[model samples]
Target chain A: MKEGTSISVSKLTKRFGHFTAVDAISFDVKEGEIFGFLGANGAGKTTAMRMLCGLSMPTSGEATVAGYDLYKQSEKIKKSIGYMSQKFSLYEDLTIKENNRFYGGIYGLSDKQINEKTEFMLHHLHLEDQANTLVKELPLGWKQKLSFSVSMIHDPKIVFLDEPTGGVDPLTRREFWTMIYEAAHRGTTVFVTTHYMDEAEYCDRVSIMVDGKIEALDTPSALTRQFKVQGMADVFVQLARKAKRSDN
Target chain B: MESIQVDHVDKSFQSGKSPVEALKNITFNVKQGELFGLIGPDGAGKTTLFRILTTLMLADKGDAWVDGYHVVKDYEQIRKRVGYMPGRFSLYQDLTVEENLSFFATLFNTTLEENYELVKDIYVQIEPFKKRRAGALSGGMKQKLALSCALIHRPSVLFLDEPTTGVDAVSRQEFWQLLRGLQKQGITILVSTPYMDEASLCDRVALMQNGSIMKIDSPGGIISQFQKPLWAVQGDNMYQLMHDLRHDSRVDTCYPFGQYHHVTFNESTIDIESLKKEFQQKGVHSITIDRTEPTIEDCFMELMNQ
Candidate 1:
């Protein structure tokens, strides 16, 4: 174990009946690094992520997330990491302040701590005036930002975001990435999955998964140079062309 | 001749106490065999305009015509001459792939064999799984099946709304290839997507936002009109770089773009050598700057902010 390793996995495998969804994947994420996970749909990216997040049991592997064993200490793992899925999981009917309080309580924050943190969060996001506004009444970009803030309310060491900027306009997408950069600057590790090739370029390192295996992993510039491609999109197309999965 | 035309069209829907204007004075023309794109984000009126052109909805004012037939007065003729694939997967869930294709063909008074040539390229990919229920198909397969069903009737015009929204990168590339093949067969394609990169694939595009057309031009032409020298700048600290660039009086606009910050000058001329020196004086280190070509996304964002 290294001093600042956030996640470490070796020969991790998962199977559903006879189908091997994730096959002997191995990787490590350093503390505060932005890791981008790229793959075509149905290419086992979700299965691998599920296992790493402690949401599902790996068929076989040696792994540690947030300095806890994946199998024996999943509950402890859950507490040390924050997750925001593609689907908006926050309560829409609740006000921004109420939603923050609810998530803070779920993370086992003391009442005094929750109050202080909630006040700081509202002020930080410039949502103090709209703290009483229902989440549904906000625009899509605001709602997405609020959801991200809620995920970080407990101040977990690591955050997993799945397609965080899907369907947003380019301007809003830029704004969202700025927020992500701030989190990484604050020493919070970020693991994100996205289909947008442009977003891949922003990560410190990226891994392209194909057919339940990691086909290529490197910095965006290195991957492009190694593949003799012009950009991350071309690198993705080149790798995806080699995929054996016909379903996606 | 123009295959489709919209002139001063307007549409709105009542929500709560106020009516939300979905389309506002929209006007455009699609030439025969042209691949035209409607590019915008969600709630930008692309779907509403598509519905009006397909004879599925009526405009509050002005007019639209498809295949030389008025959308309102001759909707039956227009519908018969156009193929529409909606944003959502709209095929029968329980029905198999083969069943869906044949059913749509029947509605147009045609047989699968009669128009199989039109959809053969797309259909063959999913033909092996013809017995699989449409709902059971994966996202990419479902997309292929929906496209095949739309083309089974061999309509002169095809309207696809955000067909590749949730599909993967590879499938999205394949879908575009399929559209190119269809265009070669003399079919005019009107497709909508929120992805700005896809706009370049079309012969012409309309950048829409807030129920209005911001600009209408060929993708290349729009990029040419950017009219400012753009530079991609990066430093050791990206977050700090963005903040400093935004505050600089010489910078007109600065936004984070991938690994670097994209900046345009407020003035017509920029002294790159001086700017580099200026950054060093401000305590920023390892600064790299390069002139870069503007893309359709750049044009869209510029117009949107205006």
Candidate 2:
């Protein structure tokens, strides 16, 4: 394992019965680096992400996350990573404070630590007075922002965000990226997946998956230049349009 | 005559004790055979407005008409003339693709054979999976089935709610092309999406936020209304560049856009050479700055701030 690499994978593969969901893929993410994992729907991104997060086992691969072995230390890897998805993360029925405490408990934090962190998070989000308010009562943007904050309650070494700004407004989407940049600035590795090509440009480095393979991996500018495209959107379309697999 | 007309529509939902306003004085009109868009984020009253126009729900204190029929008084007439595809996949999961299409055709007192020409372009893509259950089909295939069902009735006006939401870029482009084909057939299309980029695809768009309409104009019209001189700035260190630009006195608003930081100056014009030299003095090197045109998103943010 490299000294500064947060995640290192060599020829990772996952197969489902007769289908090779994720073909041999290799990549490395450095500490505090913003890595964009991009692909079209049904491009094996979710399958590959599941294996990296320790939620699923890879059929064939050598990988380490946060200095822990992918095969031997899957349990430890889970504790050292934070994850949030646009579809589900925070409990809508729970109050903001309660949700924080619940997640903190799940991460095995002590009650005292949970209390302190919850207060800090509430203060940062400017929801100190509304801590008791139900998450469903808050606006969509606030809920998404709060969800990102709570995902970091344990202050894990790496955070995985799945389309975190899917349907957010333009202004709030920019704000969410700022939050992401701040997290990376604090030396936490950020591994994010998004459909918005514009968001892909914000990544320090990006890897595009096509039909279960890492078709392209480079900085946004390099990828654009290599593809002879104008922006990340065109680069994405050129690669994704040739995909043989149907959309999932 | 307008294909769709909405006049001061308002709707509120009971969250707990107090009612949360979902739509506030929303007014817009879609011309005949025009492709109009309702562009906004989630919870921006788009679905509420769609429901009212489709005659599935009523507004609290306003009127709307679809296909020249009053939404309230002529709801039955409106329902018969409009084809609505809700955001969520409303088809039966257990039903096969073919079955769902036929079911929808039956609801409108029509048959697939009768309207084959109307949906041939979209239906043929999903024909190979006709025997497969709708739930078993892929996202793109499922969307095709839903669109086919919506067009089965061959209604004069089509209402699609966030049809491209969560869809990938390639599929979204294909879907829009299908819509263009429908428009050529003289169908008035009204669609909603959260993607600001998609606004440019429409003939005109109504930007909505916080239960209110911000502006209604052609995409080009909105861009022209943006009177600020914008610039795209990039440097080796993006985070530091953003920090330095935000703190600059002459810079108005700076936000991270795709590959560069989009900046608006308080003054109308900026000295490019001086700005580069000034950044060098601040120790921000490898600076690349150029004047850029305002996109729909830039216009959207400007209107939102106002």
Candidate 3:
């Protein structure tokens, strides 16, 4: 393993009975890099992410996340990474401050640290006034931003965001990407999966999964040049159209 | 005559004690056999407008007509002539693909065989999986099935709300192709999506934000109206470059777009060579700058900021 490699996977494979979800996929994510893992709806992108995040065990693979062994150090890997899923995972019924406090406690932050961090985060997000408001009451954009902030409250080495800006408008989506850029600037490796090709273009490097394998992986420009397409969306369409998988 | 017309439409929903205006003086028209797009972010009133046009809801003020029939007065006529595929997958999940298609056909007092020609191209794609349960189908397959079911009744006008939102890239392209084929058959298509690139596929688009239409023009027309000299810049350190560009007095707007930070000057007369020299002087080395064409997304952002 190279010193600056935040994530490394070799010949990773996952099978569900007769179905192979992720088939012998290999890739490496460098420290502080924004790596886009993209695929069609059933292209095994989520399955690979779950294995790397230590939420699910890979059937067979050699991997390390945040320098911890994927199988032997799953718990340690889980602790070192922050995750924000497609669906907002925060408690909808709880107030913003309350949710932060609850998550901070779960991450094993000291009470003093939690208090200080919560205050800072609330101020940072300009949500100090809405700190007492239920998360469900917030607009979609605010909730998404708040969710991202909460994911990073523990100061994890890495953050995994799945479709973070799925339904947001272009303007709000731009604002969200700025937040991501800040996080990456702060030396946190961002591993994200998204349907938006524009978001894929923002990553430092991107890997397109097709039919349970990493079919293409490179910078957006390289991929576009290789595929002979004008943009990432076109590259995606060209690659995905050749998918032998009839499912998606 | 326009296939669909809206004149000063206004709509609001009672949220708790306050009423939220979902549409504000919205007015647009879709030409006969044209593909019209409602482009915006979530909570921008795309869905509300779609609901009203589809005759599922009523506007508080103004008027809308579908197929030359009034939205309120002739809802039955409008409903019978239009096919609506909502954002959500509303098909029977437990039923097989064939079963769902037949059920929708039966709802319109018709059979799949009777209108097979209308949905043949889309139906054929999912025909191999006709026996598969709708819930078991993949996202793309489900999208195809939903589209097929929508057209099973042979409605002259089609209304699709974010039809390709969650589907994969290839499937989205295929879906749009199906729409084009339907258009060739003279079906007026009205679609809504948050994706800006998809706006280019439409004959004309209404850029909506905060329940109001900001601009209604062809995608090319909208881009042409972006009267700023835009440049895409990339350097060794993107975050620092973004921060520096935003703080620069000459730089009007600087946002990270893909691999480059898309920057527009505050003044049109600013030269790109000087801008590169300024960045180099700021201790940023290896900076590349290119004058880029504005996209629909660029125009949308500029309009929203204004």
Candidate 4:
């Protein structure tokens, strides 16, 4: 793995009216590393990802992604990063190749680049035979893989995956991580958020979020060691239990 | 009496130009006090089979019996005698957890007091939020509520379709423990999960794919059929090990499981000494190879390949 630019976030906050979805939180993601963003439902993982991907503005903070400013250079930040949202962001009715074309064009990729990228992605996903198949007809795993590839159409420096393998089978989740590993090995910084404890183990580092702040953040092994747990799954439960107690 | 019995069942759904055969001659029997699992990914016909077995739908071919009664001939009796928890949260969102449980109990012409002992362990967990709307609860809480309602009627058989999907790991473990408790009370459970690790929790499992039974056996039995000597290998250079093993002629199948790659040789006669030598020759310095057992995932992959 290659060393990536140090992402610096100082007291990042995102508020929607009275609800502070992502309350003053900060964490750095190094280059060429898989960082797991973990949280329960509505634990602000999505809100934080939205801010990092430059899709939403932070209420107050100084942050940079891939060395670009998160505020004034938001547009540049978007170009330097890829984001696969929870929802299927691709065109449902479009053909497999057509969705790729649509995403590439939207990312300002030229015709030649789009053509090469589509061909490469299709072959890489072993979906060359199904390029003409409508996206609606594909299985959940194929659609997820294809969607991830499309998000990287512009060759973003960092890729943000929000539950990219969610709703798929465990087998597909394994295959999906292989692709994630491939991306990281190729010097693409992988920033992902998932509730699956096993998926967190696949990452080099993980941050467990509770309430609106990160309760624990470190290498998966370190977290497991500090929490005195045998696995990440148990570690997550311990944190969740703490949160539940506080709420009570 | 057999809890559930499916004999030579087949299901097909018409898609525009052709029909999709979901299940092919599927046959299995769940014992009176066993926790059976239909383990596979989505579109593996788990839901369809469960629906037919629970008397929610009729199979196009073959017949199934619940509690020794034909599914078609005794549909009403089956419904009364079996508890079905669908994959989705089908409970009334507007009703409180207590209300939901009582409603389900009422459906069976029984009161909560009559079946309180059956679901006491699960119901106690949700009793604190008895007045909370079903939809307002957390994922884990909602799951417990669903199971409580399903058991409130004291059904002889329980069918939970992917009940633990989208839930936290701890919740999943807890739910399985609850199932085991019910099994001890002479309740037969048929649970479907896409998770391979949970396969071992079942008394017996049937691995399904594209509507066909790939294999049906105990988890240990299925893993033993791997027919290859497996090894858990880890080294300084995982990338190199993965690449080398994938292309290695002696390696039948290699997959990254957690921190190590579970590799297997095409022929069991190949000794670990020789396999280590081959890896060392491939520049995998300081490799650790130890005999490892195959996982349900490996077994499923092998079955799917064939």
TM-score of each: 0.96, 0.98, 0.96, 0.90
Position A73, candidate 3: lDDT? 96
Full-model lDDT for every candidate: 0.89, 0.92, 0.89, 0.84
DockQ values of all predictions = 0.63, 0.82, 0.68, 0.37
lDDT per residue (tens digit) for residues A10-120 in model 2: 999999898888999999999999999999889999999999999999999899999999899999999999999978578889999899889999999999999999899
Model 2 clash pairs are none
Judged by lDDT, which candidate is best? 2
lDDT at residue B41 of model 2 (Cα atoms): 92
Report clashes for each candidate as comma-separated counts: 0, 0, 0, 2
Cα lDDT tens digits, model 4, B197-282, are 89999989999888999999999999989866778888767777888888878788777776678887777676777777888888
In the range B221-302, model 2's lDDT, one tens digit per residue, is: 9999996888999887788889889999999999888989999999877888898888878877899999899999999999
2 or 4: which has the higher lDDT?
2
Q: Residue B155 lDDT in model 1? A: 92
User: Which is better, 2 or 4, measured by TM-score?
Assistant: 2
For every candidate structure, what is the RMSD over all alpha carbons to the true structure, in angstroms?
1.8, 1.1, 1.8, 3.1
Best by TM-score: 2
lDDT of 4: 0.84
* Residue-wise C-alpha lDDT for candidate 1, range B100-177, written one tens digit per residue: 988998899898899888888988889989999999998888988988888888899999999988667888888899
Instruction: Report i-RMS for every model.
Output: 1.7, 1.1, 1.8, 3.4
Model 4 stretches with alpha carbons more than 4 Å out:
A1-3, A13-24, A39-44, A55-62, A71-76, A85-89, A167-171, A195-198, A210-215, A221-231, A234-241, A245-248, B269-284
Model 1 misplacement above 4 A = B16-18, B281-284
